[model samples]
Target: MNDSAPSPTDLLSVGDVSRRTGVSVSALHFYEREGLISATRTSGGQRRYARHVIRRVSVIQVAKRMGISLSEVADVFADLPPDRMPGKTDWRRISERWRGRLEARRQEIERMENELVECIGCGCVSLRSCRVLNPDDELGADGAGPRLLPEIPTD
Candidate 1:
């Protein structure tokens, strides 16, 4: 019987939340600092997190796995009211927003794949091949860079 353990009804300590969610304590701290998750402080100055933060951390993990940047994930969480934990509706809304970004990324990948197939061993990394490599940048109006790829929108 570990008398130091938090009771079932007590808010979870940062370590407890980390153990429950498999997220590092540092990451939890980062999330807290980034405003993706939040916590309260006990009178003794120990931090305490609500159980809902576990689910919130899980959602953040899933978003990261999907190639969504932390800023993008933060934007999604921004849609939720500060007082409420992300619920089913929140998940649905965020998922819908990510669906568009994911689909766009997929299409971009497909385009790059096809382009690479043609660019293989072409050795056309010169401006002379700009017609094929970058038709829009005929005079290098956009400056030096891989201009063929479309910019992925973060929002």
Candidate 2:
């Protein structure tokens, strides 16, 4: 046996985890700070992550690509068994939980598409007459700056 070789069960250094997962070291730190993933500290105070954290990082990447917020990912992770890698069943549950939010995003996109065509075809740049912008002058009641626009999704 090669004594120097790391075993599958060995805890990984932050750089090792970053290299293996293709997530930046700073991002790994951010994930830790956000309570998404956790690590143990060495006697020298270096971060050491369990091998299963690779799977957790993968899940974070996938969730980010799907426009899921980190808070939402954290919520899902809170329900997960921390000792093991997330499996097919875990992914299924996560995706199921996100389905409604994704569906709402899809509907929002469709609405934007339909309204975009109308806005362009009408050639009426007036905010008061813009259904896509003012939406029946609903913002008038709010009395605020740039209230003619919908809230842009950040995640």
Candidate 3:
């Protein structure tokens, strides 16, 4: 081992964190801005992250893949100490909190799949026959744009 190399317990540079976590340096900075993760500054003004941040970044990546927004990740992270790594107990709590939302998303996707099958079976490509997009032509009265599709809730 090179004596100049950082130890496992030592703080990691922004680039070090990026390479280890496979998350871009820009994303690490973004996470900092969003309060999802934090870092310290070196005497030269370089960013240095705690080694535990690797695990935190992994959690963030998984949550994002599951459709959880950065704000949501921030909310979960807020429940824990910013300076420490999240433990298994912390992860259990976070996963339990997110379970309902993930289930709801799953159900919505299943419903859409069934609706799509029904729409296809009807053999009418028109908006009139499309149950998912416009059921009973109710959207026609609303004056254009998608109607029956679930509206994406904004943060």
Identify the leading candidate in terms of lDDT: 2
Off by over 4 Å in 2: 1-9, 139-155
**lDDT for each of the candidates?**
0.82, 0.87, 0.85
Please give, for residues 1-155, the per-residue lDDT of candidate 1 as tens digits: 56754454768899999999999999999999999998888898888987778888998999989999999988987877764468898999899999999999999888778766776778776564534466455557756667678889998
Please report, as a residue range, the 10-residue window in candidate 1 with the lowest summed lDDT. Answer: 128-137
TM-score of 2: 0.78
Q: lDDT-based ranking, best first?
A: 2, 3, 1
Best by TM-score: 2
For residues 1-155, write the lDDT of model 3, one tens digit per residue.
87754564699999999999999999999988887888878889888888888999999999988999888988889889876789999999999988988999899899889888887657776776577876457667778677669989999
Q: What lDDT score goes with residue 25 in model 3?
A: 95
RMSD of each: 9.8, 9.1, 9.1
Scored against the true structure, residue 99 in model 3 reaches a CA lDDT of 94
Tens digit of lDDT per residue, candidate 2, span 57-108?
A: 9999998999999999999999998777888999899989899889999999
Off by over 4 Å in 1: 1-10, 130-135, 138-155
